[model samples]
Target: MSDPTSPIGWGIQLAKLWTSSGQTFPVRVKDIALEVTKARFPEPVGCVIPHGISGIDGMLSKRQKKKDWCISYDETVTVPGRINFTIAHELGHFLLHRQQRDTFQCGQLQMLEYDSPESRRIEAQANTFASYLLMPRNDFDAQVDGHELSFELLGHCAERYETSLTATALKWLEFTTEAAMLVVADHDEFICWTYCSQAARRIGAYKPPGEMLPAGVLEEIRSKALDARKFRRVAPGVWHPSEEAIESVIVSDQFEQMIFLVRFPFALSVDHEEEPESDAFSDLAEKIQGLR
Candidate 1:
């Protein structure tokens, strides 16, 4: 091991070990968590269990009377993908931040915060660790080699990795060659968040939260009942001023969210301007304030 100190470094090291050991798809994070802690610390993780915590995905805390640690995930998270990722996330905190802090509580929104000026460093690191550990880059790329970037394809990847579709799409965006953006909307139809691929960001294909669904696209989606059977060529003026995009939507009943996957036609020129960062810390603080 090449001193796997950072999140990505540890993720890579563990992922390689898992692969070398002939472990199959959808890495069993629970086993890895225990194995890792036991090898590195006398106070290894004593338990990875469930809790009925509200408004949070997972937590890691020191034992009350002992030096050991406990990792607890939300019992209400029925989705296997979400549950698996939450366990991996808590393990990341145990490995990286246990010496610095007594506990860590993470929410879904906080897990998605990464590579931004407003992102919490440790939270972002844990997220990166979970992503890389759960979905190793080499295997993920191999899975994506011949597939078109679509919800159907990403859904398959999600199944293979035992991760949520959102997480899979975000992982794809991390290294995709296509100019695409993944926009997630709350049940009320407001754009709650978005992640853009490198190609998309180069052409300034990004949207801010709190915006309504793009004009006309919403009506089309509603008419189709969010089937995702075909992509509609939305005109330049809809999603972006200078580019046209093909759009598709998937409605997730479990999460009560709408996911829009948009791919732009190749751009003739690029935008050098950048989007301003949101008050992410303040927003996260407000969300977790009730717990305090």
Candidate 2:
């Protein structure tokens, strides 16, 4: 076994092990976590404590100058699927970034935005590692084949991976062959962030919702009905001429947010290109495509 020091290195090495051993993704994730925990600390004390502090999902604490460490999670987060993902994310940080810092605070956006270049690269790496560890590409790809990308389908994947709907959907977009986009909006006005699949980018499907939706647009028309599940499809000019259709689903809790799943015409091609290739990229691409 190679030294599991860096997050990326550990992830790649573990992914390879899982790929060859025929272990299931979720099972492998737990096994890796257990191995890492036991290797670092003495018996009984080395175990990862679940349902960490009141509000946080997971925690990692390292005493000064010690290689041995402790990891914990909030037990109140009873959703098994979400708990699994949080564990994987925290394990990622532990393996990859613990040497640099003693404590890590994880939240929804912070966990998923791992790919953002402007932010901490290690966080993104851990996220990538966790996603792959829990939802290996081979299994994910097998599920996605012949299935139309839908909220329900994404929800199912989330259940399978023990992650949130948003997380699973974002992962789906990362690897799906379909030209799809996931847009998250807040207050039905500002576009928080947008994620486009390889195919969607090629067709020029994007959103510059411009601080607010344009007057009389479907997003604006349905703004009040923010909690609705039925997505409204708009023609090309309404969203983007290059797209064959746009479907918007809004999820309003204490915060009103929208997720747009835009589907592009199968025949059209836009100039946008795929993400640059790297070791992490290869891992993710392979995981999503179920090649591993």
| Best candidate, lDDT | 1
lDDT of 2 by residue, 1-292 (tens): 5476655566566667766777654544556676755765352124467644675766666645454556677777754476676677777877767657777776544443434443346656766777777666678888888866678777777777677676677777777777777766676467665667777667666675444543446445555654334555666675566444757574645445656666764436655545674433223332221111
Clash counts for all predictions: 0, 13
Candidate 2 clash total?
A: 13
Supply candidate 2's per-residue lDDT for 167.
68
Best by TM-score: 1
Error of 1 at 58 (Å): 1.4
Q: After superposition, how far is residue 143 of candidate 2 from its true place, in Å?
A: 0.3
How close is every model to the real structure, measured as TM-score? 0.85, 0.75
1-292 per-residue lDDT for model 1 (tens digits): 4447888888889899899999998999999888877887889998899888886789899997877999998878766588888888889888888888888877765664434444466776777788888899899999889766778888888898888887788788877778888888878888877777767878878888889988777777667666766677888978887898888888878767888999985565465566453222223333222110
Model 1 stretches astray by more than 4 angstroms: 109-119, 268-292
Least lDDT summed over 10 consecutive residues: which range in candidate 2? 283-292
Q: Spell out the clash pairs found in candidate 1.
A: none
